[model samples]
Target: MKVVLAYSGGLDTTVLLTWLQEKYNAEVICYCSNVGQEEELDGLEEKALKHGAVKCYVDDVQDEFAAEYIYPMMQANAIYEGTYLLGTSIARPLIAKRMIDIANAEGAEAICHGATGKGNDQVRFELTAYALKPDIKVIAPWRMPEDFPFEGRMDMVKYLEERGVPTTVSAAKPYSMDRNMLHISFEGGILEDPWNEPDEDMWCMTKPLSQAADEAEYVEISFEKGIPVAVNGEKLGAAALLKKLNALGCEHAVGRIDIVENRFTGMKDRGVYETPGGTILQAAHRALESICMDREVMHLRDSFIPKYAELVYNGFWFAPEREMLQAAIVQSQETVTGDVRVKLYKGGVHVCGRKSPYSLYSPELVSFDEAGGYDQSDATGFIKLNALRLRVLATMKKES
Candidate 1:
């Protein structure tokens, strides 16, 4: 038998690598998708091979992740539950897509993942896998109680050590983290409790607020049709632009969110997220839309924000409804081209200025002093017409 596993070189995946080989007597192929987890990918293939994998494939999908996934989400202003930026939620489908490709190429009968039974990742992975390739079989070892009865991380570490599988992870770590170019997410361990504050040491991407620069920093982000095209006049690719913003925002201690979010599994999960670049992009994109987008069009798109965010959060990237929503979102971005200047200070982003050539805002039409193009007398009739229903309701109340 043959199988392809999504290997992360973490304790759970490393142990699963050896366990699959022993239990199923199967040849295992390890695949790691590089979606901007900078230093974490170091010696990953070597580690996977040493842990009993027949082969290891590390593919770089950072550019595709930024352009294909991140950009479109930004265009739609996707924010789940009015808080989460959907950093980890958005990365799963791309990883699963690549895993399916690897499975097909290797002619493997089943694909495996290290996602625990309780988390949202398992559903995200399987949903994408089945959506792309319906016949593909998914193996989630954590869900099987009898075959894999390990209680926790310590047990998994002990199993790996007993099997002589080398790992650098320590069981004493207080939390689990997932990192990529867009953001760094911290969960599990001490973060499981809602009341406990995240340790300062757990932050990787942004500086602590106390250590940040005292003076505010100004940054001008340029967007072309809702896509971030340049930072401070220097043009860059999607991934490079995000990395640049990440560095700038990190310096000012920007984009740190701690919230207790509702998971798809019907559990509340507390997470600490540092999304430096993503935060800046969200602010800049919205600022640009304020000028570029028409009022009614913006409101209509705003009406779909929650639904769009929910779809992405629930792992429906390839669903027909999501695609339909995405089509409309992209169409809404046709005029979203401009530059927005923002001030970053003490972990907050303030929109200072915004200008767009496609701006629907007319200074002449809105200036009160000049009467502009709007007639004040016309508003009397307009107000009377709008108040007709309210007036009728008031009369009925008086009669009663």
Candidate 2:
């Protein structure tokens, strides 16, 4: 048997590599999609081979992740339950799609992932696998036997040690993390209790709130049809621009979220995510849309944002509704061209100013100063027309 595994150079996959090769007598081809984990992907191929992979493919996929996946969610103002921007949720499908592509090219029969059955990731990873290739076989070792989980990190480390595989993980830490270009997520370990406060040391992407600068940091972002084009007047491509924004936004302690959400698989899980660049981009995009988008178009798209976000979060990227909604969202971005100046202060990305060539904001009409298009007196008749139902209700109350 030959199996393709989505291998992160982490405790799970490091052990999973040897296990699959030995148990199924399988030829393992490990695949790692670089979505900006920022870790040393160096020697990952060597490690995979040492653990029994026939070959390992390390692909640079950060640009595709940002352009094809992240930007679409940004365009739609996709916020799941009004908080999460669906960062991790949105990236999973793209990664899985690539895994399938690699699987086909390698002529591998079965695909495997390290996602446990208890989490949303299992659903996200498996759904996309099946969606793309209906007959794709999934190897989920977490549900295999009573001795699985390797009894947590320590046991996994011991198992690897006993098997002569080297690992960097130690028993000292009390957390599990998933990192990518879009966001870094933390869960499990000490985070199981909702009341427990996260340790200050646990965060990697953002500074501590107290350490953030006292004074506000101003940033100007340029948008072309709803996509971020530049930062502070300097042009950058998708990934480069986002990474720059991430640095600046993280300095201000922006985009840290703690939410215990209902998973798509009918379970509740606590997910803490840090999405600094995404925060700035989402805010800036929305600000531009205010002026550049038509009122009716904005309203219609706004109505679908929640559903679109939910669909993405629930692992429905290939679903017809999600695809249909994405088409509409992209259509809405047609006129969202402009620039927005934002002030970042201690975890806040505030829209200080916004301008667009297509701005619907009419200063001349809205001005309360002498020359104006809006008549304050005109509101009286409008109010009277609007109050007819209230007047009828009042008359009925008096009569009764």
Candidate 3:
């Protein structure tokens, strides 16, 4: 049998690669998607080849990831459970899509992933695979604990030592981390206890609040049709722009979130995420929309944010309903073209100014000092008309 596996050069996947080869005697083809994991991708292909894979494919999909996946979700202002920016959630579908493509190209009979049975990733990876290729066979080794007998990280460590397969990760490592362009997420081990605050040393992306600069820095972000085009008047591509903002936000100790969230697999998971750039983008985009978007259209779009976020969080990026919501989201962003000035300070992003060519804000009509366009007497009739229902309800209560 032939199988294509999503290979990350981690202990779990290292063991999984060898196990899949030994158990099924399958020709394993390893794939590593480079979605801006930085140094994590270093020596990945070489490591996979050392672990008995016939061939290893490492593809750089960071630009596609940001422009196609991240940007669309940002347009919807999708926030899962009012907090999470869907950093890790948004990357899964792109990885799965590439995996399915490789499966077809290799004529592989099955596709495998290292997502544990208890986590949401298992559902996300499988859903995207099946949605793309309905008949495709998915091999989730974590679901079958009996066949893949490893009690914990130590067990895998012992197994690798027994086979003389070298691994860089030490068993003493305190946490499991997932990193990409959008964000870096830390979970498991020490983070399992919800009450425990993540140690400051564990943070890799942003600075500690105490270390942030005391002086506030202002940045102007320009968006065209809800997509960020420039930062501080410098035009950059999606990936480049995000990297630039990540640096700026990291210095300011922004976009650090620690929360215990309900996972799709019926468990509460605690995760700490650093999404410096994404945080800035979300704030800037919303500020731009305030000046550009119509009130009713903005509200309607806002109502779909939870549903849109749920789809992304649950790994339904390819689902029809998500696409339907995306259509409305895109339409809502048609007028979301503008620039927003933001003030960045210790762990905060403040929108100080915004301007758009399509702005509906009429300063003259809103000026209280001048009554620029209006008569004060007009408000009396308007107020009375709106108050009629309240007056009737109050009269009924008085009579009773």
Question: What is each predicted model's overall lDDT from 0 to 1?
Answer: 0.91, 0.88, 0.93
What is the alpha-carbon lDDT of model 2 when measured against the actual structure? 0.88
Best by TM-score: 1
What is every candidate's alpha-carbon RMSD to the true fold? 1.3, 1.9, 1.4
Please provide, for model 2 over 1-400, each residue's C-alpha lDDT reduced to its tens digit, 9 standing for 90 to 100. Answer: 8899999778889888888877888999999988898988998898888778999999898988888889878999999888888878987998889889988998888998888778888888888999999998988888786535476677888888998888887565576787888799998878988898899988888998989989999999999888888999999988899999999988999999999988887888888889999999999999899888999999999999889988888898988899899899889889898899999999999999999988989888877775566678889999999999999999999999
Clashing pairs in model 3? none
Q: Choose the strongest candidate by lDDT.
A: 3
Better of 2 and 3 by TM-score: 3
TM-score of each: 0.97, 0.94, 0.97
Which segments of candidate 2 are over 4 A away from where they belong? Answer: 146-149, 375-381
Error of 1 at 66 (Å): 0.5
- At residue 113, what lDDT does model 1 achieve? 93
lDDT, residue 228, candidate 1: 95
